[model samples]
Target: MALSEIPMGQIRTYGQIGKAISCQSAQAVGTAVSKNPWLILIPCHRVLPSSGHLGNYAVGEDVKCFLLRLEGLRFDNP
Candidate 1:
């Protein structure tokens, strides 16, 4: 899937992923991401909402933040 192609330290919005896979529905992409069982292997953490904020994750938003930070992605004050 497109999620696997997303490099570490970089992120893609649900819409971006959808477009990559020829899907027009961001919500559908979000649903698929939410159901991903191979989180680490697939790097599902790299997917974010289009709002430029950290969105829902399988484990939790904190874990997602930690993962992203480990990959060199820094977040500004919200």
Candidate 2:
């Protein structure tokens, strides 16, 4: 899965994904991310901003945090 490629204890910024797939704008990646339909199955919560902020989530940040926590992902102070 594309999301699984993020690793077990790491995260990926939207801009990084955009750069990886030859996209020039992180906003484009963010738009696609917002449309993701797999929810926790695709680990969309693992995708975040480059600043280490939680960013926005259709399912709410709290829920997203819960999911990330379940995956052993920690959001540290940046």
Model 2 is weakest, by summed lDDT over 10 consecutive residues, at: 69-78
Question: Model 2 — TM-score against the truth?
Answer: 0.84
Top model number, lDDT:
1
Model 1 Cα shift for residue 56 (angstroms): 0.3
State every prediction's TM-score relative to the real structure.
0.94, 0.84
Per-residue lDDT for 19 in model 2?
A: 84
RMSD of 1: 1.2
lDDT of 2 by residue, 1-78 (tens): 456577765789999888888899999899999998887667778899887888888889888787778778765434
Q: In model 1, what is the error at residue 51, expressed in angstroms?
A: 0.5
CA lDDT scores, all candidates in order: 0.91, 0.80
